[model samples]
Target chain A: MGKPTGFLEFHRELPANRTPSERVSDWEEIHVHVPTDTLKRQGARCMDCGTPYCHTGKLIGGMASGCPINNLIPDWNDLIFRGQWKEAAVRLHQTNNFPEFTGRVCPAPCEGSCTLGLNDDPVTIKSIECSIADHAFEEGWIVPDTPGTRTGKRVAVVGSGPAGLAAASQLNHAGHTVTVFERADRVGGLLMYGIPNMKLPKSMVERRVRLMANAGIRFVTGVEVGRDITAKSLLSDWDAVVLCCGAAQARDLAIEGRNLSGIHLAMEFLHANTKSLLDSSLADGAYISASGKSVVVIGGGDTGTDCVGTALRHRARNVTQLEILPKPPASRAPDNPWPQWPKVYKLDYGQEEAAALQGADPRAYSIQTKRFVGDESGQVREVHTIDIEWKKSPDGRMHIVELPGTERVFPAELVLLALGFVGPEKKGLVHELGLKLDERGNVVTDGEKMTSVAGVFAAGDMVRGQSLVVWAIHEGRKAARGVDRYLMYGQSYLP
Target chain B: MSDAIWTAGEVPHVLFVGDESGCRDELTAALGAGWAIQPANDGIHAMDLLKHPNRPASIVVVLDLSMPVLEGFGFEKARRADSELSHIPVVLVTSHAADERVKKFGARAYVKRPIVVGDLAAVVRELGEG
Candidate 1:
């Protein structure tokens, strides 16, 4: 490490955010940029621990604890401290194809496993990495690396989300002609539409896409391989096909009045809102609005938080987010220690915004929506809800049980179901290709990441179901190695 | 030719249709008074409102590209096929501004979110007048 005494000299410091009151007035990102000097200081805090658990990427307590992609955290942090930003970017790109996306959205499990965090604060690894990546973009250090020679073999990657992008980038680097097929009008699936612009600006996504295009990766949009172009056609034209289609199917709340006019899936709300915002601002009502309405958001996850933040920005008269689970402890529990993801209560941006305007956190823990109560006109007016209590079953597993006399009516002109996704939609390409599916309905692949069909592989949410973007990139890279071995040696390279 | 009766401090009605509820709320709050707002949870309901004989005149439809049971694109295609709803202007809102589909589909314009309300309202006002 460049600065041996850096951790002793500097305490961990992250970039401050705009005050909640000032930021709630608009939809811009809340976190302000930390000056280069402050970021360098934060980077210097990397301890260069002997074990370096930050990059170990092991699963602790059934949750990811470190960098799944094994990003060279200490190396990059040291590079940033030494003013070697160009080298830091190079090291960052070695493991991650899109640090920009992860820097903004990833939970940064690396910090959780940081050695410095055991005693004091973690080395602001996430912030330092983002700063280096952003600096690289500004200095024109990040550019497309075109293959030295064309391999003549062609590969078709379905979906243009992170997994597909990573896979395509790697395979193209291996000198193979790669074409990414997207059902939507654009390539970056969730990155393009599901994620809001404030979190990840579309300009950044387009910038990388433009560079990839320049590198000879052909992005074919508005093409649904199953319907628009048959799967059979893909097998005939391309030597290999990679199914990176994300878990696009959302889980629905099957309850009374489920067909009400105002009830919607969280992705439906997020996808539409992003589309409207991208289309022509508020000129076209491509998204749903919550102005002067009482909004009820179901489920309590990142997607739900996104809904809460979006609703608060709409100036909803009232907003309430319902979570079936009990609120987490404010600090890490005894069982949850260092090097494990701290399952503690922390306010995300959306909740922070909602709290600023609504005078309290919008979330209602241990509550479940029973039904949608609609007006005579069939528009949703309210939601019937009940408080639930968790009880340990005979087997010591937790189960939700409704509490008596805890029923209440919540006014809700707009209701968003923020429950997570199930799996990729099986119709169209999946059904046409007849890909093998696991018991849970996710695409089934062997340890080699190969589907039942020959020369066909799957990765990302398509195989693993809905998961973090970092995991998707990891699977994509691993699957690319598997594909490379299959193409060259007719065997699997993944161990 | 005649002045349309409007709610006090209302600019004009702008209807948002799609699924993500949070984003809709943010847009509405940001665009407060710059535009009156209505939201449909999905595409079928939005299409029904657009085709209604008593439909709010001069209202803009902000359409999301994806949805269950009649997504924004499907609604747009169906609206284009309908003689009554076809004239209404649709500003396509999306996460993917650079997606080729936006260009091919010929939306009135594309706007990215989470956008500042002032910027969003300005775009709506421009389209409303035109």
Candidate 2:
């Protein structure tokens, strides 16, 4: 909007990334930073459309196509283009508490729904947004805003992921004494452990945590409510308790040899790998190492791709990825039009790395693992697989049918199961709390995002199943509003 | 099976177990003729082949985590329990990337399905060198 013809003058461009070959050799980020001058041009590309669909945060085609938090994209873009970076940061922070995290790891549905992308490429809103927030950090502009006055009310935020962080930040800003409880050794649940450093660096998470700490948000790591501390005790101690614990349970493969040695969950590998790297500079054998072994990754999704990339860095003997679904079309299908989330196939960074190293993409589509084969010593040695065909059953539900005579064997010294998660772990915490679960096993909540129990609220992956980080932040912000309204008007303000 | 160079000398001999023909064909093509290719129809046959005296001395074994007769974790447990095959390095491959059960089993390497021929060969070479 700053420049009337800016969109016409400049094309959309993203920061250059390290070549797949070079990036696969180490556990460093693949993207390289673009210069401020170039970033400014990208920011200027925002047309400041009258009806900016990018910020609507609506559901289209059963998928979120815009910013879930409804980030003020045009406002921040204009501010950034005008060189008012400090103002841009403030504008970005108005809606999103952690733009830096989203800017790095988010899939950017906002860009997908961008009006600019209707015909041409979308404006580089995400990159510009990230740059503005990162620049603010560098300039020390993102200082903690301690509440001037303290409200008598105290709030307890369970879980320290994006949702918990947002709830705590908002509650603190509202002058409530907010304390965040995290079960992990460190705060930033998924941000700290679930996601690898190469993607969302732990330093970024720590930097934000430090700021939140200065803002009167007390983050109590290793303190799990409902277990270490009782939910009843927390309710008695605080004016309100918000449950933001994310979904921590991984979906399992219940095939024949599920209990075999050498088969592992993707999160187990990723979490341990990150913990080891953080703890001992990669000296400890705490992480699952793919070095000097043939590796097979199951489930072709972001997690699987991450495993592929991580294994390549470890110099594994070989890598193979299997997916049950049929291969996606190279381009968007007729059903998937513009402004809808494209259901097309694209190589992610990890796949690119695997392809570069092995001279081919490491994905097998329409394949299903039948069982795990063990060696004489009871260690997993091979996997039995069969081809599957999708068919519509009499009930009209899609089901997979194993093809005839398509079975084969593949060697796998190590198997990292990258299957998706089921729901939040319902063990010590959830069981003790006695929270009601939905049909899908997620924490059940009403229209107010509050659980059946009074004075208690739920949000993020704990309420939803395993989901994107962006959605978690969105739910967290909404849940904070719900908690605030609940405290003041005895009802939720979330729409 | 094609008249290609089997660089078995430089490349590690690995037995691939699974029922997907495409994956096996792709791996054979990717590893090229340099490495010895042994395919097993099911877990039982794979185990039998591993115990056979004529079987090539493979330092590394690439196995799928899910299979019949003995699949994934079952095969790994069986292999580790046996005094003969416990020492061989094993890799578990599957389509489920983040299954915690696989991680709990302690596979040396966890490979996702839809094997990239080149990446598989590179990993195999690295294991051989190790």
Each candidate's number of clashing pairs is 39, 126
| Per-model lDDT | 0.83, 0.81
By summed lDDT, which 10 consecutive residues of candidate 1 chain A come out lowest?
Answer: A486-495
Query: What would you estimate as the lDDT of candidate 2?
Result: 0.81
Tens digits of per-residue lDDT, candidate 2, B82-123, equal: 788887787677777777787687776767767676777777
- CA lDDT of A150 in candidate 2? 54
For candidate 1, write residues B14-121 as lDDT tens digits: 778876677677767776665677777666557655654556667888888876545667677778877877777888877787778767889887777664556666
Off by over 4 Å in 1: A490-495, B1-130
Q: Number of the top candidate by TM-score? A: 1
Interface RMSD, candidate 2? Answer: 29.9
Candidate 2 steric clashes: 126
For each candidate, C-alpha RMSD in Å? 24.4, 31.6
DockQ of each: 0.01, 0.00
lDDT per residue (tens digit) for residues A366-472 in model 1: 99888898999999998999999999999999999999899999999999998999998999888988998989899998876899998899999999999888999
Q: Considering every candidate listed, which one attains the maximal lDDT? A: 1
